[model samples]
Target: MAEAYPLKFQENHKSHWARTLRNLGLAYHQIGDNTQALDYAKHALDIYARLAQDKPKRFEPDWAMSLNDYANLLSDKGDNTQALDYCKQALNIRERLAQDKSEDFESDWAMSLNNYANRLSDNGDSTQVLACAKQSLDIYARLAQDKPKRFEPDWAISLSNYAIRLSDNGDSTQALTCAKQALDIRERLAQNQPERFEPGWAMSLSNYANALSENGDNAQAIDFAKQALDIYARLAQDKPERFEPGWAASLNNYATYLSDNGDSTQALVYAKKALDIYARLAESNPKKRTADAERSQLNVAMLAWLITGAELVVSAEAAPDSALDYDRRPNRFYRHVLLAWAANDPAHAANALENAWQAWGAMSKAQQKNWENIFLLACGFAAARAALPPAFGTWQVQLTQFKTRRKAGLPQWMEEIARRKGFALV
Candidate 1:
């Protein structure tokens, strides 16, 4: 269709040409080709801007639309500064047009406001973000009341956005209310047109879950997160290019909820899955996926630390006080100890180990029994005992006996330490 227009027609019908370029940009963006999308969007905006300058009355709206689309492409490329500038320009035009022709342009005005609010959020202007989002919600609410079929989805989206803003601002009660309302509308919409509305329904579910978690209903939050994950998983299986990002996001959210509910082991599994997807995505769209990948990587690391720490403590608790048996150690424990030793950064490692030891010391016996309360302490104690100077004489004696019994099987460093008297590993 784009090739249907010859150079002569393109020169004569610039508006049509620009629209085609904008649409091509959208097509590329939908398939995750951000570089191509950005190129096409730039060209469309350039043409639209020139046309609007010559005939503002006829071309201003189209120019604003192109500006908005270009802003979105910029945002996907992590060019927030440029995106925000374009959003402001688009909103200015849309706002003026809506005032002059409210019936025809009100929706565009509201949509622009929403876009502006999001850009403000990306820039950390929380106060303006909420104000603009609220204004957008008000307009959408009125429009939806009068024309449910046409405006309900927009209204629901605004509600979800508003809910997130409210939650971020420490208004959990109001956030939950708005989230539930959005979820209700999306649920009804999906009931009638699953293919068209299910993605929105999944998004609403995720938003509602976040609200629920904020309100301290972690169980319910996990349930809703699971629902969102299930939907995204199915959708991504069919259209990975379109849905994988959502699927990865849902997995991350689900992992968070699970961690909050005291299932760090399970959380680690899902967090790793999220990290894998985000890492793969970052390879193709680093600007868009880098932050997500970094966040997922952090989640994975923290969860692994806690789980591994707990396991180390549990294994130590089962060992005899007379001797630390090398054969009794779990592979995870051995791997962790070996890794810490190999890193050879004793100062920082010692500090972390000491902090963990102090934390374990501070815990009550009952709290100690709940490994979650002393996982770090246990991990610290095991690492310090295995790789550092003898902090406890009894453990040092046990270590000496264990090393003597397992000299042939010990790691090179440990065997070397056992061969020398009063030699510390760190």
Candidate 2:
């Protein structure tokens, strides 16, 4: 098509060529070839921008849409700064277009707002997250009221985003309300059109489960999480390459819930599975999947530590000093639970701490140094469990020393934990 068309000509052929380029870009994005996606998207956007600048009435919408697609690819590639700029440009154009042609551009405006909100949330701009999310929800709500068949799905999506923002802001009750509303809408949509809406339904179910878990409804949370897992399992069976990441994420959430519920063995299984999936994904697309892969690895390591802690707490048994069954990291929840359990069963605290410390000492110097933050965190947990506040303070002092002496390579999680626990990190 590009060969057949002289792009310099003022004809509809340019529009056709641009559409083809844009579709190719979108296809590459869907298949996770983000490099090619960005290449094609930028080329399409260049043409659309030229056309829109030449004749705004005919090509402005296309230009805005191309901007949106480019922004989405950039966002997927973790370039939120560039993504936000492109998304803002798209939003400005869509807002202006909607003001003149509400019926034609209202949906586009809502979509652009959603994209902007997502980028803002990724950047942790909490103040702007709620504003963009709420505005997007309001627009979608009005549009869905007027055209349910056309806009309800978008409205449901906006509700989910708003619910996440609310959850992050610590409004668990309202977040659950919004999540449930989105779930109900998705359920209805899926019942009427399963093939078209099942994926959305599953995603909403996962979000709803997270909200329920945050609200302390563990039983109900597992029910919804399992439902989402079931759906994603089927979807991934059909298209593993496309849906496996979602499946792995759902598994991770379920594993966290199970871990909190004291199902250590099952939680370990789920965590390992999630880590395996993320490892494969990272191998295929390291640039995009490395963060998730590393986080999933951390989850697996935490689960291993939790299992060891739980067994130590329950069996009142000590492992050999040289055992390597568990990594020497401290999980906040697991450590807290062990401390609480030791409060009632004081007899095992000394043995558990001794064995855990020995296990750490058995590790190679490189491994111990590699996990210095985790080692300090574990020491703090042990000291707190032993009713030795001074010992915990000593560990914190050591952490401060490490931060002061070593200017880099310190784990950010240690600083966050210190800040959250009212301890001075620096």
Candidate 3:
């Protein structure tokens, strides 16, 4: 259909072709055809971008919308670095449009800001996350005040994002308030339109529960988290393809809270459940789901280690007999195990570190040059430092060289991983 439309629509009708391309891209995305989705989205974006270069007033908004759509697809495909770049393009266009006509472009600008905030948050870049979320929330608040029925859902979404950023920034008290306000708005909306608003209400419940947990209200956190889990569970049961990810995410969140509250047994149960769901999803859609699967696997390993007082030994049957096993372990089990043994089981931790080092040494030069691979190696090194700090004296020097060689800013998630393991990324 997309090919037929392009053949029918000549170059003079580029706008029509671009719009069709964008629509097709969206349709493909809805059906989980990410490869075709990206192809169509990029084609639309290219046409719009070229048109906007000559007639900014006529095509800039269209181009920005295409950029946003492309970013969403890239994000879903687990290419967040590219996603961030596309989101910035959309936000820049929207910002300019909003400045010229605030009433007409403010909503779009706010939407872009919210999306930018989300991508940054996912990448562990907390520096500008709060500011972008607040800017989006402010716009939504004003719009909702003027037309509650039309803009209330957008307002609630912005509030929820703002709450997440606030919680990440250590302002959990205000985060809880923001989350609760979003929950109230979603609850009201869902009461009238369950099909439209129930998912949102469930999301808000999870966000609010997270804030509650951060604020040291474990009981309330567990209660709200359970409510979110119940909603997601029901939704997933009815539509596994769409809602399973949400259910898995809720399980992970609930498990973390339970673990923090000294319920290791239940927490392990929930974490394993989340991992099982992620594994199934990854098997069905490897390109889009593998990252989530790996993270959930790590979470399960962490939970098991914690349940054993951080002294879980490598199973004799499962122990690595080859470099292939070690290579797989760095990003999955070994990294988590290294942290668990940082102070508790130094002998095993040293063994893990030695295996990780051997795996790193086995990588080719080209593989080491890739940012994604480098980030994973950096994380492995950080975990090794936590388990054996003195062994990292030379690594600090090498890290400086690595930073100097890279032109782009360091990935914040690597630092986050290191910080979680009680080490700094030198």
Candidate 4:
């Protein structure tokens, strides 16, 4: 193909050459070789740009398509800023083309709007995200009504995207509805054509799981997450490069639902699996996977801490009146502790320490010992200085005495977690 591309260029078949380049880019992207995909997409876009400038009417659509392809490649590489710029260019061209020939280009225009909305999401513009997503969904819904077979899949996808934005905006009820609708369509499609639609069905299941989880339906969330994980596991076994990311994501979501359902031990196992996959992915594409790896690592650490009964005690002590309010207290306490240690937020740390100190006075000897062990496990000494309250002098002496009496370092698991979390043990 490389040898033939030069021949096509020499013969003045530049359009053909560019189209082949774009196709090659798509191929590489499908296989998850984003580096190669981006390189090919860039070349294709350059050729298309030159051709479109010379003959706008004849080549502009192709050029816009190339821009969209390039944008997708850039997005996959974690270059969101550049991706948004290119996506806007594609949307502008497609919008104008659709205005002149709606019958021929309206679908393309709607697709570009969806892509633009996705780019806006990466930029954190919630207002514009919902606006663009709504516009795309409206267009897709109309198109699907007119031609169900031709446009139903796109409509379903638009519904899923719109659902996410709705959920993010705190419209959980509507988001759940949209997610369920999308899943219904995909389910029917998969039933009719499993080979072509099963992947999409699995994706819809994952999205539905998220919506359910957001609505506090942990049991249903876990069920859907498991189904999605099962499908992704099979797909990844057959095509690891193309499907492992999705599989890892499903594992991460499944772990969260399990933890929420009071299965921290099982959650830890799945979280570790997700972290392993993301870490391996980061080795090859740090820009794209590093954040995911870090997030999964944090999830693994949180689940491990929960399994150790630290979060339970922290929740109970942090809110004695509402000790059973496991969700809010544990997360709030954990956040304050991390902020104290990582960001040196004196106010939050002081508050957390004061609460812990008060709780310590009320505990039995066995509970006191457990609390001491948990304090060490949480690396409380690392934040003790930053979190010193009015009684810090006495507390510091007490901590020092405890440390000396123990005369032992952090447990191996705690040490590894500290290393991953970038925490220094004194």
Which residue pairs of candidate 2 clash? none
- How many clashes in candidate 1? 0
Candidate 2 lDDT, tens digit per residue, 1-426? Answer: 456546556448778889999999998877667789899999999999999998898899999999999998887765667988999999999999999999999889988988888777756577887888899899999999998998999999999999988866557788999999999999999999998999999999999987876666767877899899899889999998878999998898888667645576787898888889989988987655655666676566555645564322222223322322222222222333333334445665555455456544444332344345556765655555454434345676766655543333243334434443334444
Model 3, residue 248: C-alpha shift (Å)? 1.9
Per-candidate clashes come to 0, 0, 0, 0
CA lDDT for candidate 3: 0.75
lDDT at residue 172 of model 3 (Cα atoms):
66
lDDT (Cα, tens digit) per residue for candidate 1, span 1-426: 465768556555898888899999998887667789989999999998988887788889999999999998887665668999999999999999999999999999999999998888766677888999999999999999999999999999999999877765557789999999999999999999999999999999999997787676778989999999999999999999889999999998998778767687898899999999989998987655655675576557656755664322211122223222211112223323333332336664455445344443433322332222123223334544564334533544444433343222223323232222223432
- In angstroms, give how far residue 204 of model 2 lies from its true place: 0.8
lDDT of 3 by residue, 244-334 (tens): 9999999998987787566767988998999999899989876556656776776676567655645543332234444332123335333
**TM-score for all predictions?**
0.69, 0.70, 0.72, 0.68
Instruction: Tell how far residue 7 is off in model 2, in angstroms.
Output: 8.7
For model 3, how big is the CA root-mean-square deviation? 9.0
- The candidate scoring highest on lDDT is 3
Off by over 4 Å in 3: 1-13, 23-37, 73-82, 119-127, 304-348, 351-426
| TM-score, prediction 2 | 0.70
Clashing pairs in 4: none
Alpha-carbon lDDT of model 2 = 0.73
Give the CA lDDT, 0 to 100, for residue 253 in model 1. 90
Error of 2 at 245 (Å): 2.1
lDDT of 1: 0.73
